[model samples]
Target: MSGIYIHIPFCKQACHYCDFHFSTSTKKKSQLVEMLCEELELRKDEIGRNIQTIYFGGGTPSLLNSEELDHIFKTIFEYFKVSETAEITLEANPDDLTEEVIKMLNASPINRLSIGVQSFFGKDLKLMNRAHNSEEALRSLQLAKHYFDNISIDLIYGIPGQSNEQWKRNLQQALELDIPHISSYALTVEPKTALEKFIEKGKVKPVEDEQYREQFDILVETLTSKGFEHYEFSNYGKPGYHSQNNMAYWLGKPYLGIGPSAHSFDGRSRKWNISNNSLYINSIQAGKLPQQTEELSTTDSYNEYVMTRLRTKFGVNLEEIQEKFGEKYKLHFLKEADRFLQDGLMDTSEETFHITPNGKFLSDGIAADLFYIDK
Candidate 1:
């Protein structure tokens, strides 16, 4: 397996725009941790090779205590063959990254930290209902820098009222922190999210696509100009600092996901644990894994390949398409993509299809148009 992803499904508070599975009450935190360990042990036989990465994504993994973390680590070490130099990362929030927490993490097996500092501005933080204020976000990074070298921070752009100047300032602040990697994304209003209700109720202004595009352009220009590679659509990393766990997903490497709401993928199938924490914990305690599996069809794999590869620097290779999906699939891709190549939206010079600068903003639409769906 390329990596293992463990989801910590407890958050201090819900962000207005978030739709991910999580709970505000960490009442069952200890129980959940035990179940996660049990699930890990139960699925140990699935991985046939040494794991190269381990990522603790959240709800807010930083909420985990040292003892809790150690227990999980011990279980992992006992059950799996993890590489000595594995890129172990823990997703954190600024409020939880006190000096004590930072020092504790620094002494642990984890070598990387992905901090969720959605905004360095109080106005933006408040609007998004983020638990950390502007000062806390800045202070935590300063403290984290003293303990960690491989660090990434999450930033959200295109907040309804944020100006281009403010957006640029956010990038500049992160750059000043000497952050090696950044995962910046536009603030999207998902259905049933508070952000969506706010917009619909006129409590908040709707984010314009034009504004989002402008900020994205600003992000790409600013980060790349500072010697960071736009490795994936939303991820920018300095050389040798790209996220291994993230790359595993983008490159379609096999990974095992453990915990409520976590998703996993082998070469041919996908599985996702139940989203309900209580159901997940109960099922695991009863010696049953609460997950649903989907066996991917040829069209499913082809669509997935097109969707993910098109978003990264490693664009699709025609020969690779044919070898993996058959000649008809490759032909379909070319026939569907012929217009883009002719329009200069996609480059075909190297027998590899890459999105040109002019087409980056329309990447999702382009990828969708190329997907092979059965009639």
Candidate 2:
């Protein structure tokens, strides 16, 4: 099924390692929302399907008040065919979550809440420059659980000084709370980020890949023992609680993405909106969609398929490949894949080729190697 992703390009504060496009000022909030709504209406026919999920993701979607949120949802309903049983989600930060806000969200059509609880430790919070403290982080989940059962929380590990014991404690705490889904991430220092600068200046320690791998292994073991399925590389879910919106991406479904810096993908190509807030608004006001797009060549399409599908539990299907790209390309794909099979990174039978547990950590690299070059 298809989905919709709306990027709310605003945040109260910037985290040290974040590279996402967002503004700390609320001066352009109304204008931004209006532009987003207009973009939604403009791209209606491009994605013609009953949307099964609508994800409000961003710097922090909870920054918007109930009225603004309502306006966006109403516009989506007006311009798009949303399923009656669609899974609508909002990505919230702990500091923005309060009893009143929770009540407003519960009243709305949003069925899922993905709270950003990067760490429950005050020390870790300070290092990341998250807006919320440990107390608010814990309280947000407690208060949220009272109202919503379909909840997913995010956690970060492999911080500069995070011990293995502390990482284990984080997962244990989530299990104790009975969270249905969790999205755990390893901290990486992206170029030009504050974290990268800190490391370069020797003001902060750089990330240890070995330590990160250790933590990742702990994550897989701990979550699996807790009866959570490692559905994707960084996602774990309880039975029947997998995220429908994320699954749409892995299944290669066509979806519309609205707002500044949001990305959309149809099976054949990809498109993304402009990252600059004022520029995007100006373009849309001039009745032009402010975006860049690319038509995927066969080689690029096959590479993307291997990269995304390999991350999911449902591996790549052989017959589907043959059907889509033909027998010759499928055979070439298998020939290239044979290299990884010998290394025990992937397992294959006559019908399916799935990454092994050992292969999960090296997914990106292996997928890169499997990329096809057009002749």
Number of the top-ranking candidate, with TM-score as the measure: 1
Query: Residue-wise lDDT of candidate 1 within 1-375, one digit each (tens)?
Result: 578999999999999999999999999999999999999999987755579999999899999999999999999999888998899999999999999999999989999999999999999999999999999999999999999999999999999899999999999999999999999999998999999999999999998889999999999999999999998999999999999999999888999999999999988999999999999999999999999999999999999999999999999889989988999989999999999988988997678999988889899999999999899
**Candidate 2 local lDDT, 1-375, one digit each (tens):** 678999999999989999999999989998899888899889888878578999999978999888888889899899888899899999999988999999999999999999999888899999999999999988999999999999999999899999999998988888898999999998988988998888999989877899999999999999999899999998999998899999889888898989999999988889999999999999999999998999998777777888898999888888988887778768877898898899899998767888898888998888887777766
Off by over 4 Å in 1: none
Report the number of backbone clashes for model 1.
0
Q: Count the backbone clashes (under 3 Å) in each candidate.
A: 0, 0
Candidate 2 wrong stretches, greater than 4 Å? none
How many backbone clashes are present in model 2?
Answer: 0
Clashing pairs in 2: none
In angstroms, give how far residue 254 of model 2 lies from its true place: 0.7
